[model samples]
Target: MRASRLRRAFAVAAAAGAMVFSVAGTSGSAASGMPAAPRLPGVQADTLAERYGANDDFIEKSERAARRMGDTARADHLAELAEPGRQFLSFDPRDDGLAVEVLGDLAHADRVAVVVPGSDTTIDTFDELGTRYAALAGGARAVHAEMRRLSPDTKVAVVAWLGYHAPRTLSRDVVTTARAQAGGAQLRVFVAQLKQANPAAPVTLICHSYGSAVCGSAVENPASTAAPLDNLAGIAVVGSPGMGLRSASDLAVRVPLWVGRGADDWIAGVPHASVSVPGATIGFGTDPLSREFGARTFDAGRGGHSDYFKPGGLALHNLALIGLGHGEAVSHD
Candidate 1:
């Protein structure tokens, strides 16, 4: 009886989300006429400089294409990305776009944090001032900066990874696991690449909101053809809906998992349950912050969903500690 009621509730929620948010339009501009980017470089510490140069060239070309297409906003944004000091491991200004930006010296860093953003994240909105997705880049910068402040002698790097077509928050897609599954696969591949580049560095996935679902999928489903991610130090999720699993033990990897939710986060209202339907799962199950999930919980203060990475915030400080493998120092809820 309980299971039946849960399924019915999921169906209603899914239908409501579709009716309210599924607009009859594409997510973003396709950037169809943009020039092709250079081939991504092989994952190697020695090729870091070469990869940055190639991505820089691609950014310049993309900037020109955006200008030609009369998209001043996009062109201006690309121009900033192409600046001399900025470094990007990868850039693709097509479709919703994908980019992996490094904030510190990745080649020399022994600890690395890969920041995965949630819904509504795209190239155009990467660092846009008013959007919630702005936290994607902002959070990465905050984590990087906080890590430096916490342990200046330690070598750490933060990578802002916008590598998937994130679903819109109001859309039906956000309620399903399809996007998360695909993103998880991509994340797995990217982590493999990261390991290949620097085998000694311990990588931690810092996921936010929907991105936590992606990380959950990534850790839950390892590629059959690829080796396991042995260098994964930990995973930290903030403002999450759910991780598509019943419990932390369900995770395929046995790494340390940590979760934090802001005191006033709207996500706390989301139903933490999943129900199987005809073609897909309707929700992500098991709230990471719940005692039943069996993951460490952290104090996120009184901010809302988008404030986890706010400078000097408790959440940001704990995130840095987790990413740096100093889990003992994170403040619990």
Candidate 2:
């Protein structure tokens, strides 16, 4: 139950079989100087299902998981989360294995949050993100419900993007090497799918831990030949070491980037970690507020890494604020 144990368990699992989906970082291919991905124009929500056809398996899986939860409200909430499947990316079963779940009416929502969860994350664990083996409807679902409960009237969409191949160790195999290249390519394509679902809808890329690494790499080193998509309203990274860029301005999206780390995050204590990342070459001692990195630094109190998105956690509250365009004012204990 210790943080170190949890982090280690995840590392072992990922190194073995992709860790299902780590709520943590991967050793990106960027560490070794591999080129990023080719950019694809984003997709609109309306025609996504008709265009891509990537949602059947995900929809069936989510529905089955919801029924087993034994909680109607959660089942409904999960159903809501998976609703986005009908809107974006066509639920491509063969497409890089990225998972998608949507809550609220994507066609009408003013603000949308695409949640890219970190290590040990998976499509089936859509609700819990590896909290417990029997957690069919645990952690992720609870907070997702809280999001709706806090503001049912607000047309907010919660996406559990458990897709993308993550690293097994803190090594460069998945993260720096493959994830950096393949992740950006998939994301580029996904963004196009999302835009097709709903154009001009403000997108807030909410990334966690290793997911942050994916986000940074996607933006900093976009595909060599493609034009960039529309600006994301915002980018939020919690419990992050640093996005792959030397500074936030380096990100291609031309959006405001924000970062926070739960005070107790053991990742901050890991020495020579990011510095070890090869190509993108981010080193340790990365300050979220470094002017060199154009992001706004958020002070996320002492919740530790995994605790960032937990109920009543300061980081989660911050995420809600970022989600609502309310800025980072709310603070949870």
In terms of lDDT, which candidate is strongest? 1
TM-score of each: 0.92, 0.67
> How well is each residue in 1-333 modelled by candidate 1, as lDDT tens digits?
534655665567667667765442233374887887788769788999899989989999899988988878778878877888778898888766888898888878989999999987877667763643345777788889999999999999899999888876656678789999899988888887888778899999999999999999889956578557888889999999898878899777789999999999999978777877789887798889989999989898899988888888899999999998999888987
Most accurate candidate by TM-score: 1
Error of 2 at 312 (Å): 1.8
Which lDDT values do the candidates have, in the order given? 0.84, 0.55
The TM-score measured for candidate 1 stands at 0.92
Clashes of each: 0, 51
